[model samples]
Target: MPTNGSQAGSKKEFQYRTQFPPDFDDEGESSGYVGFEHIVGTLIWASSQASLNLFEASNTVEAVTLERHFTVNSAPDNWQPPVDIWAQISFSWPVENSTLSLYGDEALCDLYHSETTHCRHQPLTANIVTELEIVYMFSERLVSHLDSDEGIEKTAR
Candidate 1:
């Protein structure tokens, strides 16, 4: 879960580690990314950056905006424990491959170019919902970290 804003009416979202292979020549790469519309976030009792950007939730039933709000604690034994357990991520159908459809809301489809921006908030009208789904539109990459105290400290850094 991520830390909420300092004040009410304020909002924040998570930024998952969706870096890159920069290019993908097909061949399904199994290890990278979160949906752009989904927001991944983290939290702390006080202010500290150990909290990692995990995943996010959709804003509406249609998920017009990214809103991942939840909480996780900084306990040693539980990768992320909660003084009280909270939801860290909100997911949708897994991403498929990249290809834009022109028949839908062209503007939003156009606006979301990157992996995260590929989807947007829609009215959730009957016509807007679909039985279809799309893939990541991009390839997934691998991420690695050294397992040690230094690695833990680096997460904060």
Candidate 2:
């Protein structure tokens, strides 16, 4: 383990663990972590930490209300349209002169090439991206939340 700053000539150090602040995600199972300490060798699996970092950075209040509405079918080949988990993240925000709808072209791609044909890999990707989109929507809202002065805060309530 190494410290970011040198405290002594002997190199006093500490190992840092990634922590997602409470200001964003809360009360969600598997919030952004997939608990994959055993997954090894695969490129994305090896880069799990970086993937988690990207997910944490997208923490917007929009995340808490994100609803996972999707359909998945794995009866046949795993490479095609309408991925096993075709997810939709529903969110509305007042930005600039209009509202925003986040899920438009985030359709899933091939799982065969990625070696994600296994239920574990495919489901994790779908779930993670769905959540990631929710987080990104919040970052996007910042631009519009500042510009909107009048409108309706309509939702699926």
Candidate 3:
């Protein structure tokens, strides 16, 4: 990872790892494990990391917008034929205004392209915005704690 000295103030590194069960075989040389658990776990873990990164990046700049594009090149050996997993997520945060917004206009094609679908354009209430800010703050703290060396040592013990 590269560092932006002026924006970041200091360089900080974070690492994440995924552990698979001993019985599980990822390669096809042996009987490959047939389950969605690992895939789901990886997605969840990546989402957490993305959230943390977004939070940190947003703090340095006025606003940060992120779009994650996922493509599935191949499916598990046990999966049935014709499996397609392609999705995109767009999230934005304006820290100065304490606003966090998610735009999924292109996430689901059917709903997004349908003409009959009526999307509301009402601005969120003050209370709702406050709640979102609180959630963001909490997530930042939780991610920081979980990424700390002390937290890792505690979990290991």
Candidate 4:
């Protein structure tokens, strides 16, 4: 189960170990190489916001399927137990003779760039909800808005 704010090891230091290919260079490839720390941090922050109540009640979406399939714990009334939230990561690999192409890279870059450019708050807005949260109107007919702009904005339909 995932948690919001202080719980769910959000304050804990994140550590990861990487194993490179057998022919990969060690020292030369190590320094001056930047990793996806910000992206990973953003994802972890986003998971904390993926509340079932927010998804089901506030967003007006049927989440029974998500609850049934992904939830390992079902004690919603009890705040003692954190509600289960799932974050799925799918990777694309090159086929036998083909090369791998990451088309999503451009999309991610665009999103991050938009967040930086358009969002009023710089980095904190990436994690916590503020007035800077970018809101997208999917359809003019679908005119449901939260009474308060306290929760994270839904960027997609």
Candidate 5:
């Protein structure tokens, strides 16, 4: 719930919230990264907020959109479990070109592993990355809107 200074030269503060896939801490098959269903649920909530124009009021958008522009199918050979169920869930604001994708599988596990001989040194795991990505996207959108007076124009839409 922290606020950021106006990068757009406006007095209004830009506020944003950090979000995680539901059941992010649950063990076993119920973990947040276990499958796409849980991730979709989170996106659904975000979409609902947009439909209600909640974001226009507070600049507190969570997940942005469930874009279906790309699709990947599972292959029998060189395949990983849960990768078959994977879907692209983008964490980019409507105005930003940068995107962070979340995938639930071995690559993610390795990306999240502690620095070791066999693992890549990625200190920020998927969850942390997702949270930070949302914050960054929110800030980017805020800057864009405030700088060009787009916030007012967008709200009027």
Candidate 6:
């Protein structure tokens, strides 16, 4: 189950790796390049933020659902475990086709100039290249209630 903060059984783990295309450098030696590190770091940071936001939104929706099910006079004696949500998200950007002008080559400069004269770099266009999987679990009683025709009718109402 996914957890909040440093609680036990937290499913919060992050892994990141970067690869530069062979054409990123003229001689195919990316070791001497110094600018890409920042780009990769920024991508990682942004992806982390996006993951956190997704988690937060899921939690918020779960909380709202629980609260909506409670009423003034018939509150349950105990609350069930919150719905579990987990994500394995990945972000990828093709460096070779990047329009950021990270390189100072004349071809890139000419392309940038021909594309736009704003001098501001293009926005990083990253693809979320993984499926967002969310899992939900409830107590047996809650599941039974949820599966009942009355529950379905109530939800329809």
Give Cα-based local distance difference scores for all models. 0.27, 0.25, 0.29, 0.26, 0.31, 0.32
Q: In angstroms, how far off is 5's CA in candidate 2?
A: 11
Q: Rank the candidates by lDDT, best first.
A: 6, 5, 3, 1, 4, 2
lDDT of 6 at 80: 34
TM-score of 4: 0.17
Q: Give each model's clash number.
A: 19, 2, 0, 0, 0, 0
Return the TM-score for each candidate structure.
0.17, 0.14, 0.16, 0.17, 0.21, 0.21
- Candidate 4: where is the Cα deviation over 4 Å? 1-34, 52-87, 91-157
Task: Choose 3 or 4, whichever is better by lDDT.
Answer: 3
Model 3, 1-157: lDDT tens digits are 1111112222222121235333334433111222233333454455454442111122122223432222223223443543332122223223312221111112122223453444352221112111111121224555666678773435443
The Cα RMSD in angstroms, rounded to one decimal, for candidate 5 relative to the true structure is: 20.8
- In terms of lDDT, the poorest run of 10 residues in model 2 is 96-105
Q: Which ranges in model 5 have alpha carbons more than 4 Å from their true place?
A: 1-40, 46-105, 108-117, 120-157
- Candidate 2: C-alpha lDDT: 0.25
Model 2: how far residue 111 lies from native, Å: 44
Rate residue 27 of model 1 by lDDT. 24
Flag regions of model 1 displaced more than 4 Å.
Answer: 1-33, 36-66, 78-107, 110-157
Q: What range of 10 consecutive residues in model 4 has the weakest lDDT sum?
A: 92-101
lDDT of 5: 0.31
lDDT, residue 58, model 2: 18
Q: What is candidate 2's CA lDDT for residue 139?
A: 33
Model 4 clashes, total count: 0
Model 2, residue pairs in steric clash:
72-84, 95-144
Tell me how many residue pairs clash in candidate 1.
19
Off by over 4 Å in 3: 1-31, 52-157
